[model samples]
Target: MDRRRVIDLEEFADELRRDPHPVYARLRAQGPVHRVRLPGSDPDYATWLVVGYEEARAALADPRLAKDGHKIGATFLDEEMIGKHLLATDPPQHTRLRALVTRAFTMRRVERLRPRIQQITDDLLDEMLPRGRADLIEALAFPLPITVICELLGVPDMDRAEFRKMSTEVVAPTSSQSEYDAVVRLAEYLTGLIEDKRCSRPTDDLLSDLLRTTAEDGDRLSAQELRGMAYLLLIAGHETTVNLIGNGVHALLTHPDQLAALRADMSLLDGAVEEMLRYEGPVHSATFRYAAEPLEIAGTLIEQGDHLVVGLTASGRDGGRYDDPDRFDIRRDARGHLAFGHGIHFCLGAPLARLEGRTAVGTLLQRAPELALDGTPGEWLPGLLMRGMRSLPVRW
Candidate 1:
């Protein structure tokens, strides 16, 4: 096989699972986009790669691109497992579903939860402080987001632990047949939870609110749709935020001077969070999208039905866009980075994610000013879709 072909297939997947930047840098130098073979699939399967910042933003915003997996007839999920959730829908339907939950995600609502979020952070940290040494992820980063999300969504106390277990299997790189079984179980669990909420009076929680929402035409979500919505919210809500906290802390610890700068100046918290998103965002690539029709982006013609994987991590590190793209500089204006994505499909939980990130990292610095890594920084999660330290063991 040709060296390029081999690199594009097997080696690329390995490199991507570890750290894709070096490979992405090489590809970006060639052009804004490239056609790469999709690993672990049929020989004919290939995905269009969007690497440049401009191209990624454009592709994400393009209406001709469809995010619904059923539209193109290829999916990593079972047909029944694929719900008509906002994240997997297009156009007017997507708009409608998103609007239903928009109010709960507003900045005001997120701000109101600040104290609660801080309390959650402090509570988790309280447990970690006495350990002398603890995995930041398990002790703090992972639990805080899961707990906050469970509270926000009204996930039953009985199901919260199971939910976390299934979520891990679903996102794990080496997930197998058993993992798929766990996903099905999770779906079933959510189905029951939704039904329970439907029978009961509504509450202030997100799940209850979703149950109460009706479209302008008086249409309500079907049982399947509700389950799907719950799944998306539960998974995306906690998983990504866990990474944001973990990745942000790792970034700061790796750069002592920057950490000191943040410690000295409390005002830099917001910018530091933004820098974390740009430097090592949780979601390495946006969810997949397919072209509904032929389109031209960055001088590359993408045909109808063609799959496109927006290199979000690569785009954030584009030297063409930032002066020192790789540097973890909190002072840099990293606002335009495509970490949460762009356009109509921009991440709905962005405000909440930011809030969680700010509280988690800020509380950590204050509580453990002497914090340092307990393991080598290179021991990190292996995946192309998400980037995070696997075991962030730390000591104050």
Candidate 2:
């Protein structure tokens, strides 16, 4: 067992926060799975981090690696306050919740928003381009999807600045107390938002549609379920796309050849976005997955009740899967990457994210022909869950 290394994950926090790729690459070389502690976690609080491409793909769909917080002895997130959202539940329950949300989050529905999405993108660009230089995260990357999701969910009064803080903390909590506080505040806010939606006259927004939606058995989402669904859609919808835009733009700006290739052929936009997700997906690791029973991943034995974090970013860049995995190639096939994840929990909003990503990146290139990095890299989000830049400075 000496071949397997036991390292304190916190020891690598600063380096990982800057660019986790190198660390992940080194770990993948040793093995796909590792026992490590997360930031702010106890020295003894090591969990399994799956970084190999194949191992991560299988682990994501593995039933033994469950999402039920109760099964894992979790101390951070409370299912009652958060409700059993898609990420926090398993099949049967997960199956039902996904079915309900999928009814309103259909691809057809998302496709219909293309024109409006373009209009929003164009309008945001108009405001951003004139500034000549700006932090892309604030100016464009963040606002576009937040606006799209808010309008989609019938949330017209969203405070982007406030929501960003709570959402970031929830995704990568610094401590249990901070996580609890943010979740409580967010839950309260969403609860009020849902109450208002229920009392108001029905509208065409997705949230309203969900309010009136009924299954074939005449079933409907409970008050808590509605809150959970709203919370999931509002947060997950915007966060993933935000980082996708930021990371994708950063990748392009840093790699001129690939950027020029994309600029030469705007048709490569779809593939380019796929490449971006594969190269550096927004989610560094899939949310907490706990072992329901003893199991082995990549030959490493995981004990029952052990927590697991699937390395979505590591898996996408695995050399065994992609030739020259580290190289950013916009035109590469880039298929089968686990950026949106795999199996039942695959990202529900992938279509919406892809639509937004393509529009945001493609249009930005068309408008800002001379777009370039305005400064050196900024700090990356410090956690195993979210992988993205805090801000991306850019100039046209």
Candidate 3:
């Protein structure tokens, strides 16, 4: 890497994890795209980090930036550990996988899940509030989504602590060996779940539905594909919401005025959730997209086989997108934010995540009228991929 051309992002990792907007602003001031070396990556190699709003938005959907690493003669570790799931594939395959999954994961289906989501929220809060003080992430944020998704996937009760460990290793790994072990364990677990579903009578769950789902031309997800899909859905289904609730609540507690405004008018629930997604979304960047062919984005020439990340957090702070983008106002009309990303790979679990966020935040405030930060929020999750706390202590 040319010292003049490559920006060393590893130097900014600590600051980015603590508070990324300042770093994002600094990068954006220079330009939308930059050759940056991320933490744990080869110093000699660099990735194009897209930070500008318009550029990030367009880069997300641009087919030239292929989601399939294989197209560029490479593959992400998870894709190899699991298989070619939606985030790891381009059109044709993605189109097919999406269509089948969409049939089961419809908006109408999500709407029907509101009552159960609320019940889960109420139950979690009921158990948590009486304690007077609790780590919000452990007591609520993490459990709610995990419970909902586990039930949705018809996964039988298992060691959740173990599961979370594996999931974290895959997403925000501390070591390569640990990550590989986690992937192997998770892949094995998912494979078992698939086999169980395959042998057992069909159930009213996404996993079982995927097992029976077939296309007009008799195309069905093979066993390996089912395992991959299960791994994707199970992980993506809850992890995003876990951070959504954690990050959103932390934002609210930190900004008393916004928290007060939200309490005054519960009607702001919808807008507040949207604002949460915009202000401090769960993920900093969408999954890496590779340059399948040479292309230019925001005047930066990206050669074929180049790896890049679209900065969702950076885009949300772009002055070009929202006036006073860094402010934490719940009433801001934050539609079209790249929090859930843009285009085809936009989060499929977005509706579910939004619903859970709305229910979790609104219910928490209503129940714990005196809810406040018990202490400084714990350390943020390591790595730039996820933006959330390892713990957020709070009290009523």
Please state every model's RMSD to the true fold in angstroms.
2.4, 1.6, 1.3
How high is the CA lDDT of each candidate model?
A: 0.82, 0.89, 0.89
Which structure among the candidates has the greatest TM-score? Answer: 3
Candidate 2 — number of clashing residue pairs?
0
TM-score-superior candidate, 1 or 2: 2
Model 1 Cα lDDT, one tens digit per residue, 65-136: 899877888676633664668778887888877876674556786788899999999999898998888988
> Candidate 2 lDDT, tens digit per residue, 142-225?
999999999999997666898888888887777778888889998898888888988998899999999988989988899888
lDDT of 2 at 193: 81
Error in Å for residue 56 of model 3: 0.3
Specify the poorest-scoring 10-residue window by lDDT in model 3. Answer: 1-10
Instruction: Report the error of model 2 at residue 371, Å.
Output: 0.6
Q: What CA RMSD would candidate 3 show?
A: 1.3
TM-score of each: 0.94, 0.96, 0.98
Cα lDDT tens digits for candidate 3, 1-396: 232588888888889889999999999998888999987788897888899999999999898899888887886777877788999888899999998888778898789889999999999888998899999999999899999999888999888888888888888888889989999999888888899889998889888988998888888998888888899989888889999999999999999999999999999889989999999999988888999889998778898998998999999999999999989899999999999999999899998999999999988999999999998888888887888888999998
| Whole-structure CA lDDT of model 3 | 0.89
Lowest-sum lDDT 10-residue window in model 2: 1-10
- Each model's total of backbone clashes: 0, 0, 0
